[model samples]
Target chain A: MKQACSIPARAGIGLKPSHYRDALDSVGTIAWFEVHAENYMGAGGAPHVWLERLRSNFPFSLHGVGLSLGGAEALDQEHLANLRTLIDRYEPGLVSEHLAWCRRDGLFFNDLLPLPLNEESLDVVARHVEQTQEALGRRILVENPSSYFAFESSTLEEPEFLSELCERSGCGLLLDINNVYVSACNNDFDAETYLGKIKAEQVGEIHLAGHAVEHLEDGETLRIDDHGSHVCDAVWGLFEKFAGRCTGVPVLVEWDTNVPSLSVMLEEASKADRILTQVSSH
Target chain B: MQNGDGDTLGKIVGDDSKFSRRFSVYRNNVYHSLTVALSDAYPVVKRLVGDDFFLAMARTYLDGGGFPVHAPLYDFGKDFPDFITGFAPAESLPWLGDVGRIERAWLQAYHGADAESGGMNLEALSSGDAERISGLRLVFHPSLCIEQLSWGAFEVWEARGGEGVAGMKVEARKNFIVAARGMDGDVRVGSFGEGVFDFFERLHNGKGIMAAAGDMDVSVVGEVLGGLVRLGAVIGVEE
Candidate 1:
């Protein structure tokens, strides 16, 4: 069995197949790595082979994209079982899922669909989170999803919903700074105010990614969480400010679409590491 | 909301046109991500049909209630090949569906279970009594897949790695293709003759050496079995 290791309070890159060779070569250069759990759920293949090779070199985290923890229906038991199997096999330092639903009535939409932040919906998500933690036998961090629009039925603010979820389910928070920036922009809220509402102690990890800006016909601007390019200037400012509060939280630089070279990804990681270093030294 | 039940959820977002545009973002994201997953799974098919046609066909497939029923998009789109077979727009290129099948088989084999540690024990084959050897059942690797397609899908699939389908003709000939992960952990797609394909198919279905051989020439069966051994497809011999 592999030895138990914790994700250090440092910056890491989301591991992609294109950079497996370079990642293996520059293990110590990057603090750690995170992977979408569904990508590695296959029985056996190159994914598992490279993950095994890389796991030995760097601490790893399993970030899930399909759990649909906030869905209205019962959780998919088979997916939970597959996740358990992967957790046992890989033994990642941290495991997480989104604060949004991807499936409903047995049809998976493949996108993180926003959920209404009301008491009833809150009950459903809290129960699901507890059930997932119980089933996996590990406490998981729930991420705040980026939304294009808000539901009027929502009775609570985004941070309030996440705070109540952590309190009720006993789970940690994966404060995605870019998502905060994106949501704040779209919903016409202050990003720093939203950040202030989050209980920093419950934040186990931080995520930084890029978003695409679109100009609407009626002079409205929309930011889509595409994670395709470099971390923008505003998001970096948010991370730089938030880094001081969450001193040792492991930060991940996520680039899922239009993935660049390993050196580029490492440069992104180094950027976060520099802020983290300055904050911790103070 | 996910089921598109009504405007109750939609109204909650907002009643304004700008809000409707924002709501469409979720719809667009769902469609875009699922389409990307299908494209990844059926690259050769996409390459053959070109992006515009492929996107149209994929949108049609999704619009007709063909969305994935579960998570981990890797397991999604298993029926895309079959969906292409009956798709109206793709009828002109009948061979395209078979190429999709070959690509899907290649992906399945790539993600299938790892083979057992050892390869075929040649010593056991040589040392065992003739009767015992003839009655022994072969255990093939989990990743081995044999497709007896009605089109030259193998050529088209191979072309994706070469000059592509620019000036090539896709003949409607019977193609016996095998997709399996080799010992080096790379999934290889190869074409074979009818006799070899049939022999392996029989062995795959739990037939012993003599039973799988059927009425074929003994020499031909020996040569085919040697090829299977070399491919590392035969993992063990079961009594």
Candidate 2:
């Protein structure tokens, strides 16, 4: 069954170990925090200590990166159990995983691999999502991935695939606006049209992140979702447009690589908050 | 796409040259992320080998099908030490494998389970009968781990934050290191002499106080026990 989102409709930042002290100190100043579920899968230590302490003060969302929810193999039960334990302990306001696969034949590729958008793949993903929801005993949000290439064997579009998966699995969508923008640029698609096709009511959260623009050898510009710098202006524009329509959806600013100081992250969140405020006032 | 048959997968992504160029993006992302994970786990090892060498070494490691079998990245590089031991390129650096082991131990202790309260039961040591107290076994914390190496791996690990291994001498000698989460919830690593090492080794082997001490001096035993308690390594004492 679908669980109602509990996170406030404001700006949040991805909680990194480097920002623990700053995050703890600025509890009320920030809206909430999201963490990669796999990072804290350890039994106990500084990660858990900081998470336990900060969780007492602010809300959190467990964003998983290792579920391999779209893989052809059976689900990793051990990983799911660890996630369940973490959710029970942290009591996060929201939980989400990507609509991508990272494992195959018992080997984890350590990257969000692209999935073909077709009926067979859709059935596989829907079954995995349903199994995950049943295992966790709560509905989760499946995020769209930033792809570099499209599958020729695909019969449907990305939004249509996600919409059908959500319809079948009774899950929600975690709209990563930057991903939409990145995939749009790399795959030559209309970002606004992609956004228009998404069911806003099914969106439980919004993700904002930075991406790197790489000029290919063939004079082609490919957008890589690295999340290493500040959220680009193009992504911010998409987020603003999406936020205006999907008002009150929680927004999270994620910067994982070459992470800057806590102030820079807070500044990004503040920028998102400004857009959200300006949009809601309209 | 699931298998390594690139030709079949290449057909699926399309025959366009742009698609081929873009497909390498995913391959690069996977390799880059896995290398970063390894570099993070073995910072000292990476520093010792230098960035270029480390990158090449990690490339070889990944190409040799060293992908992690599990989803948790933290548990991915446990076999890296063993891999380094047999790695031909690193043959000149005989101590690199031990250094990797030490770093792995540090990471394990950092993420290990927390220790239970009431360590050592000092009252029991003070008031119990001498013979019974001497026979008491010590329960160590889950995070506590001892590494015995033939080279000065601990020295290299300690030098990670300083000037680094540049212009430094690495002595080939028997080394004993104890890594455990301290009372303050920080992973603490310390090198010790033979006496302290022997005592900890015996205790780690499930030996009691007197049995672990063997013929060692009583004063050194007391000192080692004090250090263990300080490190939060000794969780409980049982008869």
Candidate 3:
């Protein structure tokens, strides 16, 4: 059978409750929609109701911001169970999680945190991913995360590490282009070179979001991958590059905080759609 | 991994030197994030208490407790209202629990799923059968919530002031309030009386409309049924 989620190559918006009615009222040809799985973990209510309705009209990708899949400790079974419940209910076309850990031990940072690429940590993560995939009864897409710092204990490059994960876990990739751009700039690497090393066949989806440049205590600057604003010019350029390279992959426009109105978001989706069309037609 | 929770926390920081200091950074951040999630989930309570006190109280709450799981922090503060009562700084603040409850309910309402509209067509019922509709058992939405509070909890929530429920009493008395989301996406709370409660109790128990209404005044039954239908709480009717 095909993977659970199948977000189309066209542009889709992140699902927000404020736009629930507007989306239901006028879906308007948007190919797919994504929701933070954590947002709809409840047994019943408006989120479930709107999601059920919206799912009828469009394909959905359940993107999880929590789960801390790459954390040093054992994966939280309860979190995994909740994820399993959501997967069972929605049967989301695509389910993706970040290749980062937000919690250590029991304290959860509630952010997409960076991971130290070492053998022990890798073993832990691979085991967890395998277990999580098995529990959900489907392969999951692990997206590369944007990070402010890299640990000195790292052994493998990010792409090589991700490639290893795919090899071991038999999962797919939700290659987040903006994360690559932001992390490469922060860690002083070439975005194109970083993107060039990945296996495109495993890439099932793409994420395009905005970032902000923040000055650290040192003289250097760090690009914070805050999905609060519109897609920046550089990120857009990177997305266009990736789309050209990997056509027919679903593209998601994520704007989590400071979410704009539905019309504004749909406009952004249209812009991405136009470029996706250009990339594919070529 | 005997105590995976503690060991995992120790590993997250990854520094034995200045364990307290490094651990503090991770602990503080986690606490702040979870506390903020609580505050966000219960903004009305935050507004009720000033930002400063709310932050202090949140920190205190975190100092005493840890998240139950690695799930989204939404469930972390499900018992926060009860926790706040034991908070020393908040001793004088009795309605804080109610405020917290309201906030939790609001968060619940905000994220609650919309239901498919359902109701038996009232027009189909014959005049004689229509009268029996009042006695029919009614089904409540899965998200329907009824919270009872003392000291005008609803009024205080509606006011949204920083005075901190100044004159409100914190007695253990109950206030009957029904919380349900309307069809238009408006979440509302209203006073539910004994009559309303009994009517619902009967309807929810699968009692027929006429039988459910048998003990109640005919006019009161009609009014309650009409109100429930208008509230979108009663989705279907069967004779």
Candidate 4:
């Protein structure tokens, strides 16, 4: 089957269960919907059912949260197989996974934990990305994760590490602008300089979301990528900067919790659309 | 610790005291995350057995057994009912397993896709033959889950709060339950009798309505048949 979704330089909302019916009711002019692949990993259910219905109207992107792509040990083959099955079934417009690890010794944490950007870990991640792309027989996008702490053992910066992965594996980048803001704020880095270093051509898609702040030791603040509320001012400013460079990429608004009504989500999507339109028009 | 080859759990966890402590932290994280996922998936089950008891039961379940390899969070609790059966503390709560059955069925119904049930078509069949349609093969929607319980499982499952009930009560009788979703996305639970169960069994076995419910009480079976039709539980009836 042909890929069902394509990024037409437009904005789309992250699909949630609460808005499935209303989304189906009003999918017109709404660029596409993105979903967490793990949520639909079932034989048959409402997620799969509504996904099928929504796919008929709008193209979709499968943003995976599991897979532990950057683990110390070998990558999880079963997780790859599940991803393959979903890709084959859905034929999504875009397939993306985070550059993080959530498993060790066959035990999975089910959370997108951070990875140290080092030679050993980079090699492991590249091999897994190559195998995953080969398994799906398609180009996959690697998303930058929101990290709380930087490992002292790492040598390369996050942008350089991601750029190298794209170069070595021939995979695409999923530029999560919210993640960049969250990580930069937590680690005291300039988000704009970090975005400037990333190879723009390698980015296949972009993500924007809301984050929660947590206070840590020594007056340090950590911005958690909660994706449960409206788009913040700072993240939107950073997104506008990136959108200028990557003009045609599809931008998805991710809201995983405290999801509002369908119209409320649409309002968020409209905000993204306005930004993309303004950037492209210039 | 073995490196670059097959190893044991000790090799993975390590022999160092700090490594063991760190491993425990990671293990606790995984177990707690999965328990929260299960709690979300089975809220009714969590409510049935208060939060503390449920967490304690979940901790014991994890201690005894882990989830299936690489299964999604939604499909994590398929074996929970069976685990509840063998659990020492839950053994006295005989209805617990049955409640689990209901929870599992509810989960299935909640997630299963909408499909046209190829059973009896009430509109096509002559109105006069509807009552005589006993033993007609009954095909339920793919979402329908029926379970036969030893006691008042349906009641115990739907029961709320700390109600006082000691052993066998007035409702501790064998019951047949069906949970199915309708075309409009509304889910429902209903009960059936021996005749209806026999008919459903036959239909699920690919028999037509006439062939399945052929030997039952004509009038009582007719009532159940009309109810199924009104509920949109039956999609089509083969002649």
lDDT of 3 by residue, A1-282 (tens): 235446677889997888888888766667789999987877566667788899989888998888888876777888889899888888788888988877655766676656677777778778878988988888888999886555656888889888888888988888888889888886678998988898888799888988777664435566777687899888888888877878878888889778899888888889999999888888
Q: What is the C-alpha lDDT of each candidate?
A: 0.86, 0.86, 0.73, 0.74
Note the chain A TM-score of all models in turn.
0.97, 0.98, 0.95, 0.95
| TM-score result, candidate 2 | 0.94
- Model 3: how far residue A26 lies from native, Å: 4.3
Candidate with better TM-score, 2 vs 4: 2
lDDT of 4 by residue, A25-113 (tens): 79585778898898887656567778888888998899888887887777677778888998889888899998987766665667776
Provide the fnat value for model 4, as a fraction from 0 to 1: 0.23
Output the better candidate (3/4) by lDDT.
Answer: 4
Give DockQ for candidates 1 onward, in order.
0.74, 0.72, 0.26, 0.22
Model 3 quality (TM-score) = 0.78
Higher-TM-score candidate of 1 and 4:
1
Candidate 2 lDDT, B1-239, residue by residue in tens = 32344453434555567666777888888889999999999999998888998888888887877889877887888888888888999998888988998898899999998876645665566564768768988887788877777787777788882576766677787877778887578787777765477778888888999999988887788778777777667767887
Residue A21 in candidate 4 has what lDDT?
A: 82
Off by over 4 Å in 2: B1-16, B123-133, B164-168, B193-199
- Docking level for model 3: acceptable
Most accurate candidate by DockQ = 1
